[model samples]
Target: MAQHWIATRPGDLEVFSFEPYDAPAPRSGEVTIEVRAAGMNPADAKHVARGRDEDFPRPIGYEVAGVVTAVGPDTEIGSGTVTVGDEVLAFRISGGWASEVTVAASAVFAKPASLSFAEAANLLLAATTAAEMLHVTGVGEGDTILVHGASGAVGVSVLQQAAMLGARAIGTASGSSFGVVERFGGTPVAYGDGLEQRVRDAAPDGVVAALDCVGTDEAVDVSLATVADRSRIVTIAAPDRAKDEGFIAIAGALPESQAYRDSVRADLVRLAGEGRLVVPVARTFALADAVEATELLMGAHPGGKLALEP
Candidate 1:
């Protein structure tokens, strides 16, 4: 028997329960893992917070890193062939808050030797989202962009990935989180009154795009005022604003976005493997402390990503 977390009913963290579970043999194209680390993100909780009655018994984690324990016959992992005992990471997996999981082989990739299990577990969701933002905005060499919530995980990824594309980022961050923005090669600006002016001053050459991780109206308004091309503006947080204003909004759940994210996972892993991309993990909690860790993640910035060490 293995242990895993689940939401017995739709609600908040109180509904989460850790229970004994039996992982079954993998079907074709499926693989089972002895989970080492499980990534924690806002969506893990938000997706189950409120939904239809039928969505109950939802799993609590989205990504994880582990050793491959079993594979369906003749299965090929996403990056290539995988064997038992292989160290790997998987994304878009259900019931990841467990000691073992059975997930589609296509979602698994070789874990980089350079990244700790915790870092690899925390990698894809935020990194792939950032990659999609940069792609849709047409960001490239010599481009300058504005990023909202730049200290957050997605925003931090945006800062680093933007730099890789030979683009410059002018990021909005709290006074305390300014270091994170600067460390990732972004120019940090306080996100409050006069934000538009602050961004302009930081990027005198001009901001060709704006990516919003923070959904505040201020973020939307400032982005609207700063970027000349509305089509170059994108938001992961403000879907209503995207519909109302006609820019762009994307989520991992959407088919197009999911395709884009899935396509880029291997490249992102390769980058991390080479130590070119970094996952800023702030803390790792024991499996039993997941609820407390999640409470903190939902509150003030923990300064970086959080993970569950199973």
Candidate 2:
């Protein structure tokens, strides 16, 4: 038996309950894992807070690192990519908060030996979001970009990936987190009342694109003032403002984003394995302590990733 978090209806983290489960035998092309660590993202809590379909008791997590325990019978042998006993990381897998999960073989990747289970579990979604944002904005060598909330998870990934692409990145952070942004190879600018002017001062050459991880009116206003092309501004945080605000928004709700994520999944895996990509785990809690971990994640910025160890 395994235990996992689930919500019967949307409300708050309090709506989630731990329930025991048994993994049914996987069908062909599926693999089952003994989840070692699960990564927590705002999306996990947001789904419950915003509500979902009438489906009761839906699983609550999205990514995890674990060891393979079973492989389903399949003529194609998709499980050949991994086998029983191999350590792995799986992303975008629904219900990943469980102590055990069965996922499509294609979604699992080899975990890098250099990274701990906590680090490997947190790498996918943020890094992939960063990659897709760069692609949609056409950011590349010689380009300069501004990243709103650059000290946050997605913002940190954006700064590092932008550097990997040979682009200059200017990151917005609280005065306290400026060092975090600078260490990731981004020019650090404090965000507040004069955010636009701060960004302008940081990038006198001008930024060609902007990625907004903070959905404030201030972030939108500044990006619009600096980047001539609205299409070059993308937000993973504020989807509601994207259409009316004339900026691009990529969310799981969009088909284009789903396809984009699928295409670039392998790249994120490779980057983490090569050590160019890093995920900083601020703290880890026992699986039973999910509520406390989640409260912290949903509250103020924690300076690093929060995860659950099963």
Candidate 3:
């Protein structure tokens, strides 16, 4: 029997419960994974904490890296055909916080040998979100962008991806985390008082776009003060600000964002395979400690991505 984490009802960690489950054989266009590591994201907790009654008893994670245990007849993954015993990572999946899971084959992809199971498991969701932020804002070579919360998971990804786009990123982070932003190729600026001037000092003139990952009022206000084109200002964390201030707000749930993210997965995986992209994991927790793991994730200062090993 495989063990999996689930939420019995809408709430916080209090709702988490583990149960023994029999992972079914993969049907056509499906694949089963013996999960090695499960990716932890704020969405995993946010969705569960605010879910409707009908969403009860739902699984708790969206991505995992593991060995393929079974594949549907003639199943082909994102890059090519899939077979048992192959190392793989899957994203946008259901019930990934498990010892084993059966998911749609389309979500599966080749795991780069260069990355550990933990890193590979955590890659796509944040990377793809960063990619779409840059995409929607028209960021490109030689452009300058500002990133809020550059030391956090999604913010760190934004810094690396922005550099790869040949863009300079002025990142907002705490003083101690300045190294994290610089290591990822961003010019780090401390948050709090005088943030707007710090960003100006880093960029000299102004930034072409602003990507808000922290979603604080300071972040929103700074982005507004610096970037003239409101269309180029995007926030994944501050939906209320985006709605109220007339900037862009996107989520994986949005149809256009979903399509774009799905389209870019293979490319992001290849970048990792080439050792160009990196996912820094701050900590790992046992699968049984999912509630504790989620507490750290919600703490929002894990210093990097967190993973659950099953």
Global Cα lDDT for candidate 2: 0.87
In angstroms, how far off is 205's CA in candidate 2?
Answer: 1.8
111-144 per-residue lDDT for model 2 (tens digits) = 8799899998899888888888999999999999
lDDT of 3 by residue, 95-201 (tens): 99999999999999999899999999999999999999999999999999999999888888888888888999999999999999999999999999999998998
lDDT of 3 at 148: 95
The C-alpha TM-scores of every prediction are: 0.98, 0.97, 0.98
Mind giving the per-residue lDDT tens digits that candidate 1 earns over 200-296?
A: 8888878999999988999999999988899999999999999999999999889999999999999999999998899999999998789999999
User: Clash number for every model?
Assistant: 0, 0, 0
RMSD of each: 0.8, 1.4, 0.9
Instruction: Evaluate residue 167 in candidate 2 and report its C-alpha lDDT on the 0 to 100 scale.
Output: 97
